[model samples]
Target: MIAWPPKAAPRIQPIGAERSAECAAIHAASFLHPWQEADFEQLFVGPGTVADGAIEEKEERLAGFIISRIAADEAEILTLAVAPNWRRRGVATQLLAPHLAALAVNRASSIFLEVEAENAAALALYANFGFEKVGERKSYYRAAGAEPKPALVMRRVLL
Candidate 1:
């Protein structure tokens, strides 16, 4: 069974360029096409990049991280991943909740993302938070352990 982080005391912190390597490692373990260190480095320095990490108190290790950027009236979730060992905890919720709230505070009209169509767990998570399918990209992602898969494009309008 997949073990999850303890839910009661998880914490979230802004992730900076210093932790790019660690973030890259976690991304590698948790994703099929994880971003490289250089990619995160660019993101940290890029015009609209914003990112955060979820950590358990005392250990200071990354339980999950979310990468997003605000562009005008929209916020895009570029990537969000939880360590395989940390799946099912409230870590993803913790990481995304504040970011989405912040975007709403900034008057963001909506948020959008693309995920592999077969990622049921992610689709459910996003759906629970009110994201809806807006479109699709054919063969958008390389499957977890197989060839590429179709991508579902989803969006959530801030109200």
Candidate 2:
């Protein structure tokens, strides 16, 4: 059987202004509708926003990232991306473990995220982390030359 988690774990660190371009590059490679560098800048400056990324130690490249915001006792994930080359190799888990811990430390009692219903990989990842489907938004995501896709709202209680 194949090893579930890779042996060489990714190096994770807090994402800052200096890493915005790298983050944008990884996001563009991962998603069809990618966030611009300016959008990442806005997120970096936003109140209560928290971001972290996984890096390839040898290549010094970003492999994945997670961004979220906390308000009161609740937190919501804005985006999560993993470079195509790094998918299914535990990069997302490395990014999420630290991000969730940070949110819990910040007194967040619950965390929420929206995932496209058809994204099996993301649904599995979130479910593995104890997230449960709480609601759904019909036609929440639109792609060029394709019909809108529904989004599943997932929640995890931290407290």
Candidate 3:
């Protein structure tokens, strides 16, 4: 029997230092090189930084998260990840909405994020949200045992 996707929408909430371990776990499952809990802790304590997680209440698990830093009139998404089982289920979208809204409310004029050039799903998601390619970083991601990959910088005007 095929298992249907969860019917209940995941709740989006602010993520605190207490949830760093959970965020690290999800990051490990989502990325080739994951951020550690300590890294998340640093981000939590940083000024102008914000993070949100998508919590699946029934399972009591964090399905996805997005972290960003707002400085002056600009914001930058530092990282975004979704649990493997939660991909293609709107978890990332849910996590991003409120963070973007908060940035806009704070008077941010634009938001920027870097995505691996080959990540089609992320490219599509950003495009759907009106993000446009603005720049490229050469060999921005160096995963172990693989060739370094290029990163595309995408931007969206919030004002």
Q: What is the per-residue lDDT of model 3 for residues 48-86, given as tens digits with 9 covering 90 to 100? A: 987888888897788888989999999999989888888
Q: Once model 3 is optimally superposed onto the true structure by TM-score, how far is the C-alpha of residue 35 displaced, in angstroms? A: 0.8
Give the candidate number with the greatest lDDT: 2
| Cα-lDDT of candidate 3 | 0.88
**Mind giving the per-residue lDDT tens digits that candidate 1 earns over 87-109?**
88767877888878877887778
TM-scores across all candidates? 0.89, 0.93, 0.93
| lDDT value, residue 141 of candidate 3 | 89
What 10-residue stretch in candidate 3 is worst by lDDT?
1-10
- List the global CA lDDT of all models: 0.83, 0.89, 0.88
Order the candidates by lDDT, highest first — what do you get? 2, 3, 1
- Rate residue 81 of model 2 by lDDT: 92
Q: List the residue pairs that clash in candidate 1.
A: none
Give per-residue CA lDDT, model 2, range 49-150, as digits (tens): 989988788877787889999999999999999887777787888889889999999999999999999999899999999999999999999998999999
Measured with C-alpha atoms, the lDDT of residue 39 in candidate 2 is 90
